[model samples]
Target: METDENIRLRQALEHAAAELPPLPDLAPLAVREGRRRRARARFAVATTAFGAVTAGALGIALLPGSDPAPATPAAVPSSPAPSASPGASYPPVVVEATPGVTPPDNPDGLSPAERERRAAHQQRVAALLDELLPEKVTGIRPVKDEVAVYRITAGGASFRMAVSVRPTDEPLAPCPDLPEERGVCETVAFDGDREAQLMAMPVNGPDTTGSYLRFSYGKSRVLLSVDPEAVSAPVTPRELLDVAADPRFLDLVEDTDARPVETKEPRPVAGG
Candidate 1:
């Protein structure tokens, strides 16, 4: 009894239903997907926070006026300064000693006390000579077994020097008068009537050059002589006279005059 169009419509509906696929539950799949999405989002947030912290630390380190962390310093040892040697200013004093040499005659036959006194005085005179003489004179030493005599070393040569004090009453020996014996002589006048005679003469004949000087003190006659046989340039008469005129030298003469060093009888010149 149904119409033809209605029957055809029912058949089409049955065919469509038969062709459709069966549906499954979607709850587990949706839960798994949501957990995966949340995990990915947490990882992205952690990465962003780590990057920000790294950049901030770098910026602080690179800042222009910021002080860097201090490092430990290494240890180092210190050294001491150099010190000066002894007797650096003045040249050394040398004493000469020879074995088995016949000691020169001690004509004065000075007693132990007298010899001691003379030795002390001679040392003082040697010190003064070292100060007053030219720098070329390297050293002055007393002659062995001799009084008032010194050996001067200068310009790589040895010379003889004598300083003595005697009674003023004893006349100063005149410079040689004979042509064969005479030398150049001159009288130097000092303050007041004080005068000194300076001479350049021969030592062992006319061929050698020597110097002699004499001056009168209060009551004493001080004599100084030099024999520059080997010296390149001998001490000049003017130099010798200047030393004689020094007040310090006069003081030494005064001491000797107060206490006589020579006997009334004349003795051979010292260091002759």
Candidate 2:
């Protein structure tokens, strides 16, 4: 017996046939059309049966309060469309700083505690900067007062590091007032080869308030970065350190003879 659905389908087919395109061979075309329609009906019926079976299985598996385990959801079909990742929003991160205790200064203007504290503080900062690994470098230069600088010039950007000797018996460091986002003291970073480290620190006043940014790279973890001028402010010590430890970029480290990159203050992140 034809179901109500079949009756409705017949009426719909008649309506469509009345509107079909005119063909020259009516009888043969009609026969072909009938075959095509039957084939399509069979395909549709198979597809519908498949869908119903799938739905029923899913429903049985997903039944709530059932003693049996739930069914796993089916894998979504791959689409030609591209989708963005949620974590992609994390900006190219550089580093995070950790504060520490500083020691008192030695006579002659510097204390052993001050130097130790500053060095320790810088170390923490460097650890953070180490996160800036896998960076590209551009140029290297030597500076005055036993100093050198490496200039990084890639990754949609430009940055420089200054390394110098810390006053052994000194009071405060002899470095200069870094521009914004730079610090007189900073942390360190390890190289990809884990061979060398670059160091940077600021030469600013105690009242310095804004966040200081600095980094150092070294051959081993114990090596205090020989380069202090390499430091920049307003950046996490880690990123700057990443640039230092980068080898190809290390060429930018002045050969103690290469032309020095003109000194400039650290710039602020726009609308950051």
Please provide, for model 2 over 24-126, each residue's C-alpha lDDT reduced to its tens digit, 9 standing for 90 to 100.
8688988967864564454334333432332222121111232211121122112201221211110111111122221222213534443333233222222
Against the reference, the lDDT scores of all candidates come to: 0.57, 0.31
lDDT of 1: 0.57
Predicted model with the maximum lDDT: 1
Model 1 scores a TM of 0.56
> For residue 7, what is the lDDT in candidate 2?
100
Q: Work out the TM-score per prediction.
A: 0.56, 0.20
Off by over 4 Å in 1: 1-100, 104-109, 173-178, 231-233, 265-272
RMSD of each: 45.0, 27.3
Model 1, 1-272: lDDT tens per residue? 88999999999999999999977789999996786456345434433343243322212111123221112111110110112112111111122233222333444576756655555555556656755665555656555345556666555455668887867565666644636666778887875678888888766756678888887776677778888564323687788877777667766677777876655435557899
User: Scored by Cα lDDT, where does model 2 land?
Assistant: 0.31
Cα-based lDDT at residue 155, candidate 1: 51
Q: Where does model 2 exceed 4 Å of error?
A: 1-161, 164-189, 192-203, 209-232, 251-272
